[model samples]
Target: MGKKSATVVLAHGAWADTSSWGKVVVLLQSDGINAVTFRLPLTSLADDVTALDKVLALVDGPVVLVGHAYAGAVIAATHSAKVRALVYIAGLAPDQGETVADVFNRYEHDEKAPKLAPGDDGLMWLAPEAFGIAFAQHASPEEQKALAAKQLPISPAAITVPVERPLWKDVPAWYLLAQHDHMIPEKTQRFMAERMNAHISAYPVDHLPSVTAPELVATVIVDAVRFVDG
Candidate 1:
């Protein structure tokens, strides 16, 4: 298989939708790599994994699974055989018996990180004002506003649920660490990436590097595609 023959499935993190991967998808498509993104309901970890599994089933041949933020854990929980590689974009990779919250709270959060709280509906959202600075500081004012407007709230239960055997332990993996991320500390991202034995690509971007630095993000994903296809 070649890079163009492999499908790249992208999973967005919490407080984001498929649009989060818009730029990367465009780049991948332009390169003749089949790229697609799925919408995780942000309801629970299991549900998100199942949703990804469904997307995987729809894709033909080999796939490189790319995840961001919470979707990192969601992609790891998948047992799909079609997934040839796993790519983490400042994603959380929890080991078996560990919940996303466990890994998330392991490190001291950045002081500027937004204080997240679940509404009565049990969905957690980032503060609208914090979206620009904390999430995507590198993005333009118009892009930041669009991101805030289309943001999706994740359920609290999603973070608390323990993960199964992480796919990273079985499949080759790559991690793109956002150095300026306030939501998940850079130290934490390094820790998780090292534990997964992932190929690391560190950049001076914020949490939403897929939006802020899509070219860099696409380059990393394309590397993974080549690696897996070879």
Candidate 2:
């Protein structure tokens, strides 16, 4: 497969899809780096990890896996030796035997997250109103509506299951703390960074930095890669 191209595989968070990355991917590609954003199944932790592994297997060279929100846990479980680094964007970076729910309940149990309840199909979906405030406050009113209309449901099991493997302990990590993030409170992001002992950066953007501040977010991810490369 020729020389494996250096790549950055972006994993989107729950309640969103690969398209949520939008301009952030463009910015990374503009830097002469290969950037790929994969759609998360968001159905179960095992399913998300399997999907990421499939995407990683397609990559030719060293990779940096970037995960947002719940995909942070997804990346942790799907990590491979080919991956050079990890970037967590206001996401969960749970250790082995640690669940997102455990982290949330530890830090701020009452924090306002999307009302995630299980469905008859045994998956967790967000309440529609959460799309406007929790998921897409930065988007235009119409844009938010459109996103809410197509939001993917996550599995309740994914939230409560601890990562079977925690890659952050092995790989170089970059944590971008969103100061104004409502979905995964700013304090919670900082706490995760501290736990991971990650290379830290910050933005005043909301939970979805890829949409609100793509340039800055991309710079953070790129900078992390360059730091490791150097």
Candidate 3:
């Protein structure tokens, strides 16, 4: 195999830590792709983007930034020239002047999806059952329990604030639409992908496919890396 010089930076979504990308990271490394997972503070869109920028600066080569669910907005909120391509896994993409809430709420939420509201801490959290019920229903009982235990809470500021001009407009983009995602409707994902002209790869997976269907997640990211490496 040819030497793969590009790096894949994985960003986890709301209510998740970097551990969510555990499976995908192992698979990318096995294929000789340098991969790293960036943890979002779930504070605000600006904070997450700033944190990602710091991680991008440390990498030595071009990058194929990959985001899952809500992290999709974090990955696109950067101005890093090193980021050559973007891969969105059941991600949310908002256009310029639009807020993440705008795009995420464009389509009606599934009845099974949880009603998210911030606790007294001013941070919104996902209920433990939501992991098994909607987030990653495909995941095993043990895995779902573990996923719920280490969850993070996202700030309303992160979703309510408007996104800047998206990097997908200029960078090559690949979208993995999760057909079974109850959180973000499949039709909503399609609308965003088509709006950005991203290459679409739909799969019968839930919102957290990076956790339940790592192979497919890795493949889409690898494809984006190859496109940039070429």
| CA lDDT of every candidate | 0.91, 0.80, 0.93
User: How much is 72 displaced in model 2, in angstroms?
Assistant: 0.4
Any residue pairs clashing in model 1, and if so which? Answer: none
Tens-place lDDT per residue, model 3, 119-179, is 9999998999999999989999998999899998999999999888999999999999999
Clashes of each: 0, 1, 0
What C-alpha lDDT, on a 0 to 100 scale, does residue 131 get in candidate 1?
Answer: 80
Pitting candidate 1 against candidate 2, the one with the higher TM-score is 1
Candidate 1's TM-score: 0.97
Which regions of candidate 2 deviate over 4 angstroms? 1-5, 109-112
- lDDT of each residue in 199-219, candidate 1, tens digit only: 999999999999999999999
**Which pairs clash in model 2?**
4-60
**TM-scores for every candidate against the unseen true structure:** 0.97, 0.91, 0.97
Clashes of 2: 1
lDDT of 2 by residue, 128-176 (tens): 7776776767777887776777777787877888677688888879999
- Candidate 1 stretches greater than 4 Å from native: 1-4
Better structure of 1 and 3 per lDDT: 3
Off by over 4 Å in 3: 1-4
